[model samples]
Target: MPEATPPPAAGLPELPVTWRASRTRAVLLPVAVLLVAVFCVLARAMPHNWHTNDRVALVVTGLLFAAGLLMLARPRATAGSEGVTVVNFVRTRRLDWAEIVRVNLRQGDPWAVLDLADGTTLAVVGIQPAAGRTQAVAAARALRDLVDAHATARHRR
Candidate 1:
């Protein structure tokens, strides 16, 4: 009887392997503080004369700022031999390497994206742009390179 080849080791990396944003406090904290300031200013200026719609807008803006701040406060993404992990406020998703098809870094947008085999896209929002444009570009390229190398290495067997 002929011997069968063993499956390729589920080659993946270790955890605590984080891809974090560059300027967490600078980008998010300032915006959050600005939002609060705006809210206070609006409240002081309009006191009781503000319409319901205006009040709603202020509340919604405040919530958005708060959410942004929270996300920035703890920005991190990890990938291992098992899967890719993302952490955001009240939400987390893990995806196996096989699910990822390609990665792309678009200009103007704040982050890179992982194009999945299922026609879905996962945003790598954890990578902040403060590392500067050059670094951001390099990071995006590195991500795409890693995905390609991993996938190619797996299929070669």
Candidate 2:
């Protein structure tokens, strides 16, 4: 279990806190951007000897860069006073913080999972373990803190 988050002193924004996939995945956005730029530059500099297959290759490269950008978008979640949003590859889920029972990132788990009090579990694609154990654990701990703080604040009100 993680320790509690210290209360903010004053004049702090509490409505939005966003979490993303591991650093490994976060790095993809820039890399994909770079690749697209490089491909465009190379293609522009050397359009000679261009064949039908060359066009195909260019299309394929563009698609690859797009895919990389999509990969970067995978597994994102955000929290606020009201709820949390988890955006996975295919779908997105939003859950009120009060509905969440626990957040887990066990050994060998690909991503974080939120176990609801209702007994159904939802995978939080944002907090992934691929970045490294230390980082992943820290992320999980931070998430727990947010959940605890918000839930407690809600109960007190």
Candidate 3:
């Protein structure tokens, strides 16, 4: 497991901070996975002689349920001195600070959007407005500050 924020420093800002998912996800994901696991386990322990189709169905269902659990982890964006790491529902990306052009968190938007220099954008889904106004805004500001701090340092050299 990666640390949310790196060790405290004297003057420089810390590297490696991550935006996590909502509390709802924190609570629901484990419970759902546990339930599915328990169901599969119990089915396996049943005394009845299971047919090949039944076993296959059980395996398929378990796999599908596990796949769905990935979303519960939600989107996480981690910032380090070298760059940013975005872990979305299905994919992960790493980009250096120079690749990012701007941080955008507009009203009515669900989360912070990072406008990349490549004419594309990256959504910071871990900092969702659905979590709460105060939290969402604070997260956006923190991310923006991180980007600004790095950008300023990079420009100086």
For lDDT, the strongest prediction is 3
For model 3, give the 10-residue run with minimal summed lDDT.
1-10
Model 3 error, position 144 (Å) = 0.4
**In candidate 3, which residue ranges exceed 4 Å CA deviation?**
1-13, 41-56
Cα lDDT of candidate 3 equals 0.75
Lowest summed-lDDT stretch of 10 residues in model 2?
A: 1-10
CA shift at 147, candidate 1, in angstroms?
Answer: 1.1
For 48-103, candidate 1 gives per-residue lDDT tens digits of 87887887788677878777786666655676656568765456788776788987
TM-score of each: 0.59, 0.70, 0.77
What TM-score, to 2 decimals, does candidate 2 have? 0.70
Error of 3 at 63 (Å): 3.8
lDDT against the true structure, per candidate, is 0.67, 0.74, 0.75
Model 3 clashing residue pairs (backbone)? none
- Badly placed stretches (over 4 Å) of model 1 are 1-16, 26-68
Query: Model 2 scores what on Cα lDDT?
Result: 0.74
**RMSD per model, one decimal:** 7.1, 5.8, 5.1
